[model samples]
Target: MINAKNLTKRFGKVDALKGLNLHVKKGSIQGLIGPNGAGKSTTIKILSTLVIANSGDVTINDIPLKRGVSVRSMIGVVPETPRLHENKSARSELRFHAKLYGMSQKEAKSRISDLLYAVQLEDAADRPIRGYSTGMKKRVALALALLHEPEILLLDEPMSGLDPVIRKQFKEIILDLKEMGKTILVSDHDLYTVEELCDSVTIIQDGKTVVEDTIESLRHETGSIAIELRVSDDSTMDGLESKLTSLDCVTDVSQKRGWVIVKVRDSKTDIPVVIHTASNHTDILEAKQTKITLEDIFLKFAGGHHG
Candidate 1:
């Protein structure tokens, strides 16, 4: 439902967005993943009509995204950091948002109650936000963003710094919103979470789109499936190399200090060949196959694994 073409945003000598182009289908749960200084938050701000780009074009729902009186009625925004008034109670904070949207006192109260329940914050509704936990405040922020029932949500690192349980809750909430046909554009570096939650992804590096596709398709395009071989000795890689590469699925192989790393075009049938090679052609302690996770793909492209 959103389209950006030749979008470039520069701050002095730094190009935060270097001719970025994005296409997010309507009602799709799409992710924007990249490293630090990858222009993720900048893209969110431009789309939310909160920041003006120097030059570019973007459209939301066939309408050009420009500063307009009614733009607020169609978009919801959750920033990377919670900006709630520390002194305000959670209930009051949501109510304030409802008031800004011109809801009557009774309507605001009813909506606030429903939102508090949706976010599972009813028990702590009366506590000042200053005393709330990180996850608690994020829930309230999400509730406030949804108070107006906007059609699209722009989330900037919505799950950053949350515990695993809280991340699962947020992922479920995002999926629920997707089911309701609310278009979501989220920027996060958490590959595992994004792969679990997003239908498609657009990967950026150094302020440019590198890959954009369904997670599975991107994995395929990476041209390799990870093959983990537990061999009695790493020297087995040499005896198995010819047989392993002879298989159609096996594309490449590498031997480490004692482990064999094979990149396969497909893991379904190729894994067994690897095991057979390790067993008959050579010697092995064990062998198994696993799909290459997004983390693996990122590390491959990043030139070296971080740890």
Candidate 2:
């Protein structure tokens, strides 16, 4: 439903995006994640029509981003920091946007009522936005974004500053939007939320895309299991790493602090051999098995290359 190719943008001498590419399938929630200054916000801004790219091609629902085509009506945007009228109540805010959207009074009222309920701010819909908490303000922003019932949503850090309760509620609302067949592109630093919410992810670095694929495919390609081993003797750690590296099942082995971290392909078969091999070197202090997460994948592909 959304596509961008070879998108590049520059401000003075610094390049915010250098050939960054992204794609989102219809009815799927896609994640855009990277380190700070990796051009995530810049990408979102260009996609939302807030910033024009220096050179690139973009389309929303097959509508090319050109002077004559109208992509704004097809997309809703929830920025990292929502800018709302502090004095206006949520209901009034929605009402104002509804007018800008060209909705009649009856339609605007009904739509505004539904959105207030959807964001769980029905009781406080009439309260001034300035008195609302951060989470409440975000809810208001979300409601405003959905007031037009756009086909796609571009969310830049939607989970930022939200409490656990509000975050959970926000997640549920996003899932509900997916079920309703809305295409979503979320740019967030919260990998856990991305793992839970996204069908696929695009990791970028230094203003370029490093990798883009489904989480399942990334896990399989990057090795899913990690074996963290702490040995009784610090001297034996180096020897253990060498032995684990020679094993066919182990993908990677490295030492950190007093622990030897090993990435393995098959946990069931590899874990035992890994433990047994370490036992031969020295007494085992601790051996724990963990699944490699999105964060691990992020560091593997996008880390150590940042300027």
Top lDDT model: 2
Instruction: State the lDDT of candidate 1 residue by residue for 1-307, as single tens digits.
Output: 8888777788899889887788899999899988888888888888888788877888988888765634667889988887999999999998888888999999989889988987889999999999999888888888888899899998888887778887887888899999999999988888888888888888776767777778778788776576866676655567776667777777777666576778888666777766766678666766656677888666656433221
* Model 2 score (lDDT): 0.90
Model 1: how far is 60 from its true place, Å? 0.8
- Candidate 2 least-lDDT 10 residues: 62-71
What digit string (tens of lDDT, one per residue) describes model 2 on residues 60-99? 8888897666688888999878999999999999998999
Candidate lDDT values, in order: 0.81, 0.90
Query: Where does model 1 exceed 4 Å of error?
Result: 234-249, 254-259, 267-269, 300-307
Give Cα distance to truth, residue 186, candidate 2, Å. Answer: 0.4
Clashing pairs in 2: none
